[model samples]
Target: MSFVKALIATWHLSILIMFHLSRMRDLKSFYLGYIKRHCQQDFPKQLSYNRFVERQTSVGVYLLLFLNLRCLGPCTGISFIDSTPLRACHIKRAHQHRSLKGWAQTGKSTLGWFYGFKLHLVINDRGEIITFRITHGATDDREPLKSEAFTNKLFGKLVADRGYISQDLFERLFIDDIHMITKRKRNMKNSLMHLHDKVLLRKRALIESVNDQLKNICQIEHTRHRSINNFCSNLLAGLIAYQALEKKPSLDLEHVVSTLKRA
Candidate 1:
């Protein structure tokens, strides 16, 4: 393909893949039913199944990253941070898995131990993704918050779970004008928090809802990945698909505050 033709093909194919994923279609059905049967009318030619997958996988990761960055919504100063497990394979198959051998690792979550990577996300109260990072399952949750690249543009309050509770991390973000709010561990001394902040903490479920939609609706998590490049591509595409969603879970700040005041 010529340079221009390749570029156009990539653009069209990327959109088609994302659209299919949003509708919960696995790649096989997407290629066979949509691209093979229908897409030729729009493209100069139709690629065989293997060739299409090869071309799509060969496309640069930066293209998907750029698309993801573009899909991010504006920062609302109140952000929720969390991570979810992306298991590469079932526990029974972990020993036999070679595709993600060196890259994926065993990690623990609330659900128990699993073998996979961790998807860390920072989203605003509006349920729009602010930024995200993927780390090994064993990596500390608070480690990404220390990166300037991840938190540079982030300001205001960040609410998270107890996993992110660290005095040093708190102070570091504080220095950058980002207030970190997390539930005090039971063993820690009580710290007074404003009612509004407490309410926002309860509303952190918005981010959890986003995670569910990304995995279940956008089809981010699967055990069938064959290559790290395609894995990353699928993940980035899923995130972009979620970003294109018309409606997202959000908190009504005014209503929350009013209800608290009435109490």
Candidate 2:
């Protein structure tokens, strides 16, 4: 009986160690080496040691997503935009922490004040993330739309928030031939939305649900870093890790359509 108990304990420990190794093992040797160094020196035992580094190698994940997008044949005709907070630390330590360098800041979220950055994610109708940008808390969601990051994207219907609305942005996107859908501000006079526009506008909430799944189910916003560089590294890593799951792309549009029809 004693031997059997000891064997079971050994098996469980081995399985836990293997799971960590499997997640981190495919990471590039250089990143692995970096994590190994940190684990031996700076990393706290409480941080899950090498597992922390394995989880933050998000660049690797992006490379894969970029490739998967290439495999999708053509760009989908629809896309959605949303922003979420990526807190690096508690708000109480916002100023005291000098570690995140330029990569972190205090951002106002729907959840209230948080100390960290904002991640603007643009995903296509097919539920594939087409582009992403990490900005300081002060960066506006509309600011990135005009940049060259989206310059070549010519023909999709862009659905975003009122925060992204402006005559300049609307005209620019119009010139590029992309249709825009956004709710009007309360104070704006003569604002009217077509029935279809109202229906499409309601779908914007789907992106918010995607953000929730990323943070909650996939654990993207759980930061355990003190340095500025590692914070960025970890942020990117979580996103990439989420992307790696693209081997099984997220829900299909047909499923979403079916659920909506039933509702």
Candidate 3:
């Protein structure tokens, strides 16, 4: 069973590499060869790299699952959303000129600040990612909500931070029957958040942890792609790689069962 799992897992990684390195034939060939050497199975020799990526096949199905799978039992009708900065490198490279130069910018983060794009992720109560959108640093967190990437998500209540709260956004989501749950900003006068909302808002922290896992564990945003095409290639590859690593929803079965019981 372990061997079967490993084979299945490695195949998915191979697909991701194909996607990311597609633009750089040399890198793609080299990395695929590296995988073949490590696996001792000549995985790359089994198929044309371009054809394999185009087919998508099982890998494409899994991407769908990542965005639309239902929890094993019942959904809490809750979702969490957040965004993280993806810097190509230090700010020193800002004016050096690159393909993605106009597509990213310096943005404020909890770590002080950084220059680059932001990857927005939306996850469910069970911690399964439902949707993702990459945006310019100057793009507002709420802007992606208008994107088809997120507007089409199959969810109910969305939990986010103050950056995502706006009267227009709330109204827009409400039209889709998805309620927006976020902390009230100091400058705005609105109805007080319910005690339950406050409690659920705390769970929003899970998305941040997920961001950390993507960067530190999956190395998604740690690339130095010199061109915008390469940057997008790496970003999509990272998403694919993370999906491959995600065996089940982030929650343990015990916790999932407990949440279901409470719901």
Candidate 4:
């Protein structure tokens, strides 16, 4: 029956999420040694690890829906934006890497060249994810911002690092009533900013911290992916897992704002 199939799909999705949250890093060992040997009651009927992986692509839609409908937080006007590199493999291994060969590309970050994709994120002052996009490693950081739908829910001040400095992008977001704030490059000329804007810029590290949790805690990035589809499935499950976390990196905007005014 369709209902039975749906239930199985949900069960499979849960297991994938558990793998990301679990201390075990290897999905095979987690599914076989942990779930199969110990959690039989939790998953009464289970497929072999190979079969489950082959069909995990089925739950991809549900993962996206849950993240959009449940995990994502409301845009709170004040936001921080940044991008982090997701290296599929070391640059030295790019030539021989085949699993993500076509999907992932060689891209360079401040940390140096990496062979992978870029995850662009926008988070609010309370450190909740507002919007996110994944692009090939070579994609421009400013490309996603050009999409109206990508930033439709956002407004007010958006803080970013020096890498996001672009006049055209700034004017584009300005037209949408979303002001983009970034640290002025040493050679560039921009007028003095307001006290509130300057104070918020100091908190740009909040986005970087969020990125850290996504990689280190959620375990979104790893070099062990064998299939491109599973690679995506793992990523979505990781983001969903992050939403379940009780505490996330955040800012004390009220106190900071009041203190800035007093100064």
- Whole-model lDDT for model 2 versus the true structure? 0.61
Error of 1 at 148 (Å): 0.8
Cα lDDT tens digits, model 3, 21-86, are 333334446446755456446463444555544333445444434334532123356778888999
Candidate 4 at residue 134, lDDT? 92
lDDT of 4 by residue, 1-263 (tens): 99999999999999989987885777899999999999889899989999988888889898988898989988898999999999999999999999987899999999999999999999998889899999999998888999987999899999988888888899989999999998888788768888888888888899889999999888999998878887888899998888788899998978787979798
Name the regions of candidate 2 deviating beyond 4 angstroms.
1-74, 244-263
Q: Model 4 residue 172 lDDT?
A: 86
lDDT of every predicted structure (CA atoms): 0.82, 0.61, 0.65, 0.90
User: Candidate 4: deviation at residue 178, Å?
Assistant: 0.3
Q: How displaced is residue 20 in candidate 4, in Å?
A: 1.7
TM-score of each: 0.93, 0.67, 0.70, 0.96
Q: Which stretches of candidate 1 lie over 4 Å from their true place?
A: 12-22
Best-performing candidate as measured by TM-score? 4
Q: Give the TM-score of candidate 2.
A: 0.67
Cα lDDT, model 3, residue 49: 52
Ranking by lDDT: 4, 1, 3, 2
> Which candidate has the highest lDDT of all?
4
